[model samples]
Target: MSHLLNRLTPRRGLLLIGLVSALALGGALVAQHFFGLRPCTLCHYQRIPHATLVVLGGLGGLLPLGLSTRRWLLAVGCLVALVGLGLAGWHVGVEQHWWAGTASCQAGGAQATSLADLRAQLAAGPAQPACDEITWSLFGLTMAGYNVLVFSALALLAGALAGGAPRPK
Candidate 1:
């Protein structure tokens, strides 16, 4: 473990982080397409951070950047990971009914102002899946819960890597 950490340069670490995020995103997509686990609004929202991290990681790894710039990129990645952690935690709470989801997820949107509006809304196709519903789980942990764990670890790793990297002279 120490040998691995010692060899984890910023560029390599960022690339690894990016690869992990991409894998997670791919898994989510596979779950959606192959297994027919439709994502709710919150689930879609949860994907943004991973997408951002993928871009950040790729750029940080590929670019010929100075130590300070590399550290800055990693810092940004850490922040993004924290944001993902928050989103996933919130999603888990919603799924567990600890708090209400958005209006769209509860009671199926704003009460139609009139019959015509109701019909029009109904014609717009099915309402998006409720955020509070757990569409998938493993070992009693929903995907969002697993996301919380993953993002938290990512954030800590990125932060530590960024902070520990030697400063440019």
Candidate 2:
């Protein structure tokens, strides 16, 4: 196992990150489109970093590059993923009520004169996705929790790839 991983060049490692990011993003999109699970504003915010990282990581993988470029890609790439992880973690906390979610995501915000007015305001907010209500869950895990898990795993793998110590096959 270590031997096989040790043999993967940096380009391969970056490619893996890119592919994983895309897959995760795509899966979320599918959930939203087909499963009727709409993402809240925070969820969109968390997704942006992942999407950006995927594009950058893919370019880094395919670009013929020198050592400096490789290092920069890995370092910056990890940071991007880390940002996603942080956002997802926060969203998970919000879902769990560990902290207050934005008033927009759920009810209990400042009220408008009419339901129509409140809905319109919510539609126009910074986080159009709403921070309060979760769209879906599995084993009690919200989408944000899943993102935290996946992004953290990706960050760990990226760290190992950056370390570049030859591992056993």
Candidate 3:
């Protein structure tokens, strides 16, 4: 069983990871579109890197490849997952009111401007999803918290892939 799993084509590995990421992303989009659970700017910002990583994973599988390249690609995936972890941690902190979130959410930034600016800021749009709003939760964990747990598992998979790679002298 282990051998069969390990023998999967690199492209397939890429596809599996991409598919997982896309499913999670699509789920979030669905929640936002259908459920109207708006996301804060920071939450959105945190997603960008993971999106990039998913794309990279797909490309890595397609490019001319070998064990070393595959290892590196998986390493990149691990790093991106870690990046997600950090952003999730920050979101959790904001949710806990341990810290204020982005500038738009608060008014004490160095760039907080005049009365017009303040008025514009207020009127700019609906309150960006508050980091602490807790739009969705599962098993008593916020989305960010869930992300940390799930992505950590993926990172471990990446590390295992690296360890299983053919060693060089």
Which of the numbered candidates is closest to the native, going by highest TM-score? 1
TM-score of each: 0.87, 0.80, 0.75
In the order shown, the candidates' Cα RMSDs to the true structure are 2.6, 3.9, 4.2
Each model's lDDT:
0.85, 0.77, 0.68
Error of 2 at 143 (Å): 1.3
Candidate 3, residues 64-114, lDDT tens digits: the string is 777677777877887777787778788788878898887664423334368
Candidate 2 lDDT, 1-169, residue by residue in tens:
4675577766777888888889889988999889877778787788897798788778878888765676568777788889889899888888777887665566444568999988887887633455757767889888888889888877876766767664321
* Cα lDDT of model 1 by residue, 1-169, tens digit: 5467677888887898899899989999999889988788888887999999999899988988877787888899999999999999989999998998776666356668999989999898666678987878899999999899989877987897789847331
Candidate 2 contains a number of clashing pairs equal to 11
Candidate 1 similarity to native, TM-score: 0.87
Question: How far is 83's C-alpha from truth in model 2 (Å)?
Answer: 1.2
List candidate 3 segments past 4 Å from native: 1-11, 105-124, 167-169
Going through the candidates in order, what is the number of backbone clashes in each? 0, 11, 1
Error of 1 at 68 (Å): 1.4
TM-score of 2: 0.80
TM-score of 3: 0.75
